[model samples]
Target chain A: MKNNEITDITPKRRLFELNLGDVWKYRDLVMLFVKRDFKNSYKQTVLGPLWIIIKPFLSTFVFTVIFGMIANISTDGMPQFLFFMAGNILWSFFSSCLNGSSSTFIGNARLFGKVYFPRLVMPCANIIYNTIGFLINFVMFFILVLIYMFTGSNVHPNLCALLMPFILLSSALLGTGCGLIVSSVTTKYRDLGVLVSFGVTLWMYITPVVYPVSQVAEPFRPLALLNPVAPLIETFRYGFLGSGTFPWQYLILSFVVTAVVLVFGIIVFNKVEKNFIDTV
Target chain B: MREMNENCVIKIENLSKEYRLGAIGSGTLRHDLQSWYAKKRGKEDPNQRIGAKQYTKGDTFLALDGVNLEVNRGERIGIIGTNGAGKSTLLKVLCRITAPTDGRVRFRGRIASMLEVGTGFHAELTGRENIYLNGAILGMTKEEVTSKIDSIIEFSECEKFIDTPVKRYSSGMFVKLAFAVAAHLDAEIMIMDEVLAVGDMRFQKKCIKKMRDLATEEDRTILYVSHNMNTIRDLCDRCIVLDHGKIVFDGDVEDAIKIYLGSANENFRALEYVGNEHKHHADRNDLCLQFVRYNGKEDSNLSKKSYHCG
Candidate 1:
C-alpha cells in the first residue's frame, strides 16, 4: 500500500487489524514481560509467591472484621468468610488490571522512548500476568468454598458456574478498557495518576463487592447495577452461593459498555502511543 | 554513465521538525496572562508581538529542516553530524518512535532499531526470558523467535546464567545479551545508533563484524549513526552530512566527511561547548584567529601556519 493510504486508516481500526498477528509476532516479548513481572513480583520476598495467597487472605479477614462483624453488614445469607473472600478476590483482579494498565505508559516510558513496538503489548502482557495472579487467588477461594460447604452453609454448585470464565474475561476487558483510557490521559496530564488511585478505591464501594445488591433499595438498585464490575461480581457470587440478585439486563449492559470502552480506549491509546515518547 | 539500478529502500522528501525554544513551563503562564490582560484592554498583546519577534531572531533553531535523501537496499549509510544536528531525531522519525512535524518519510520493508542498549529489557526477568521478550519487542513471532533462541543465547555467551534474573547479571553480560537479541531480529532495515560506543572494544568489533555481515550477506539496508569517524569511513559505502538541520553533503563517504569538516569553519565562532559544568570554545583556539576589525577595511586571510590565536 502507498504511504498516504497507510496513514489514512484510523489507529483504532489499525489496532484491530494488528490483533493476534502482531501479538503472535511479538509473543516472545510478551513472555519476557510476563516472566519479568512474575519473577520481580516475588523477588527478595521471604515467602515469595505465597504472599499472593497471604495478601488476599489477610485483606478478607480484615474486611470481615470491620464490615461484616463491626459494621454488621448483611451478606445475602452466605457465610461471612466466603462472602468477603469472594469480594476480595474479584476486587483484587479488577484493581490490578486497572492499576497495571493505567501505569503501562508511564512505567515503560524509558523503553518507549528508545524503541518502537506495539505499545498495546505492554498492558496486554500485564493483564496476562495479573490474570495468573487472579487464578492463584481463585484456587484459594475455591478451597474456602469447600470448607464452607462442610460447615453446613448453603453453597450450591450450579452448572452456571461454568460461565465463571466468561465472567472473568468480561471483568478483564472492563479493567483493560478503563486502564488504557487512564494511561493515555496520564501521559499528557500526570494529575490523572493521582486521581485514578483515589477514584478506583471509591469505585470499589459502589460495586457489590462489600455488600449485596439487594440491600440497595429499588431506585438506587439500578444505579448500583450500572457499574460493569457489579454485574461481574454478582454473577460470580450468584453462580456459587445462589443468593445474590443476578440481572441479565445488567450483564448485557456491562458487556456492551465494555466493548465500547475498549474500542475508545484502543483509539486514544493508539494515537498517544505514536508520539507520546516526545511529550512524555 | 548509466543510472544505477539499485532499488531505493528509504526516501525522505522535505522532512522537517520544529521544537519550541526555552523552558516550556511557568514562563508560558506569565506570557498567557499578559496576553489576556492586553486583549481585555482592546490592544494588541505587547508580549505576544514581542515574543513572535524574538522567535524570528537567529537565536531560534530548527532541529531538522527540509532535508531530502534516499537510501538503496543493501547500502550501508552513515549519518554524521555534530551534536544537536538532528541525527537522532531523523533516526527516531524513521523508526516511527516520533513523527515529523512536517513533510513525509517513505520506507519499504520492516525496520528494526537498536537505538539504545537494553531498549526492551526488563531487569526483573531472566536472561533467557528477556531474549524472548526483546525478540517479541523487535517484532518477531514466537515461532520465529523460538527457532533463533538457541543461536541468540550462544552468541551472547551467557548460557550458564540464562535462568538468573537479568538484574543480577553483570553490566557487560547485560550488554552482550541485549546486543545479541538486537542482532538476531529479522528485519529488512537495521538502524544502530551509537550502541557500539559503550561496550568494550572487543565487543564493539564483534558488533561491527555482525553489522557488516548483515549488510553484505543478508542484503539488509543499514543506517549506522556514530561520532566515530573511523568506523563510519570503514563501514559505510555512502554518507550523508547534516549541519544545522540541513543536508550539506550527500555523496561518497570520503567527500561527505570533507564537506562536514569544512563547514565547521562558518559556525566555529558562535559555537559553544559545555563540558563538565564549564563552557569552552568548540573550535581549537590554536587553529583559528580572532576578528581584527578595522572600520571600512576589507578582511584578509592569513596563511594557516601564521594565524594568530583567538
Candidate 2:
C-alpha cells in the first residue's frame, strides 16, 4: 500500500458524485475501447470500414422508396435524395449513439466483472466511437450536398449549418444518456435490453427521420416536440437542407433534458456497475 | 517491522455480500415489488436470511457474511477454502469488482488484480493490442503499457507472434500472454487467483519466483487465492481459511492448512446423514449399505457383513 493512496470500498449511495478524475485518468482505456469497436465491428467483412459508406446509401435507398416515392411525403422543396440522405446520416449518428452506449453494461460485463476503473469510461468510449462514425457519415453527407450544389438546385445551407458540431454532440449526448440509463437498468430487468432496440426504432419515427416534423398535423406537433429528439433533427434539417424550422425553446429544452438524463444515467450506471457482477 | 500493527493498511469491517437465489432480478416482479415495499417500510429486507453458519437452498444466498480481516503492508495472505466457501467472492469484493452487501473496506493503495486468465482479452485483437487494452483495463496508463510492451512480450515468450490476433494463439500461449501483462501491472496492492495453475512446470516455478519477488522485494501487499496447498504454503507467510462464507481459521500458514484439510473430511462425514446431524460413522447405515441387497433387508442389518474393495 502506498502512503498517499486511500481507497474505500463501501456500498456506494451518493448520487451524482460522478468521478471525473478516474474517467480522465482512464482516457487511454476509452480510446482502446473505441479502437476495439472499430476493429471488432468490421473484422470479418471484405470491405472492412468501407462498409460504413455503403451502409448510408443502402438505408437511404430504403427510406427513399418507403417514405419518399412510395408514401409521397413532402421534403419541403429540396431533392428527395438530399433530404432522405441527410436524415439517414443524422439518424445513423443518433441510433449509433443509443445502440453503442446503452449496451455498455451488458456487452462489456465480462471485462467490467474483472476490473475496476471508472464505469463511465465504457459508455464514453461508445460515444466517442459513434462520434467518429458520425463524422464519417457527415463526410458522406457532405458529398451529396456538393453534388446538389453543382447541379444548380436551390440547396441553400443556412447560417445555422455552423451548429452542426453542437447538434451532433447533443445527439450523441442524448443517445448516450438514454443508453446508459437503459444499460444500468438492464442488470435488473434484462427485458429492457430487448426493448431498447425496438424502442430506438420507434424513437426514430417520431424524430422526423423519414419525414419533416412539420408533416405532422397541428394537434400532434407539441407531442412530437416533447420528444427532445425531434427538435435536434428539425434544427439539423434546417441547417443542412434549409427547409425546416429551428424552435429555440425546444432546442434548449432538449439540451436540458439531455443534461438531466446524462446526469441520471451516470448516477444509475455508477450505482449498478459496482455490484452488477454478482447479479450478472 | 511487520510485527508491529502500525503498518496495517487494509481494515475490513463486517463485509458481507448477499446473492439472490434465482432469476436475473431474483424471480418474478412480485418478489422485487415485495422487496421494494419492505425497504420502503423501513423494515429489514424480507428476503434477508441470517447466514453466519451455512447456506441452505433459499430465495437468497449469503455469499459472504460479516467477513473481517486486517493486514499490514507487504503481507502475502493466502485465502483457501472449498467450493462455495466465498473464497472467490471475498477476492471479488476486495477488488471492488462486486460490492459487498454490507460493511466497508478501508485500504491505502492502488489495487490491481488478475482474477482469471485472460480476463479482458478480445479474440479479434492482436497480442500487442490486447496487452495495451488489458493493461489499461487493469488501470495502467497507455504510456506505461507502451514502455513495458516489449518486456511483456518477451516475458510471455510470444515475440514472433506479438502482432497476430489472440484467437490464433494456443490456449497455453494465451494464458502466458495474459499472465505476462498481469504480472507487469504496477500497483501498491496486487492480487492473483490461481494464475500459476495453467503454466508449465518451469513456467510455474518462474511465476512463483516472480510472485515472491513482488511480495518481498517490491514490498507490495498481495492476496493470493489458490487450492494448491503447496504453492500457498510456499508463497504465503500467513493464511486464512474460509468455510461456508465465513472465516473458520486465520493463523499461522501451516496451521490454517491443517485445519482446512481436516475440516473437509469432517464435513464429508457430517453429510452422510443430512437430516440427522449427529450420526457416528459406525452407526451410519451408508457405510454397510454399499453392498446390501435390494431385497428389502434393513441397511442396519447388513452392517454385520464384511466388505472388500475391488
Best-matching candidate per DockQ: 2
DockQ of all candidates, in order? 0.29, 0.53
Q: How displaced is residue B281 in candidate 1, in Å? A: 19
Question: How well does candidate 2 score on lDDT at residue B309?
Answer: 11
State the lDDT of candidate 1 residue by residue for B1-310, as single tens digits.
Answer: 0122337777787888777675332233356567678779988876754545434335545788988887888899999866667899889888877777777777767888889988878777788878877877777767877899999899888899999989899999999999988888788888989876546778777878888898999888899887666677767898887755777677788776554543443334242232211113322321232221212122223212122211
Clashing residue pairs in candidate 2 are none
- Clashing residue pair totals per candidate (backbone < 3 A): 3, 0
Number of the top TM-score candidate: 2
**lDDT, candidate 2, A1-280, per-residue tens:** 2454667788775676667788999999999989998999999999999988888889899989888999999998778988998888888888888888878887888877777788889878888887887788788788888888888987878898898877888889888888888888777777778887899888887778888878899899888888888888888878877887887788889899999988888888888877887766
Candidate 1 residue spans exceeding 4 A from truth: A1-21, B1-6, B22-61, B157-163, B265-310
What's the C-alpha lDDT at position A53 in model 1? 80
How do the residues B1-310 of candidate 2 rate in per-residue lDDT, one tens digit apiece? 2322457768888998888754454534456787779879988667655653323456677889889899888899999865667998888888888888899987776888888878889999999999999999998999999999988999898999999999999988998899999889888788888877666877777787888898899888888998777778778988898765777778788777665544433334434343242223322332232222223234222321211110
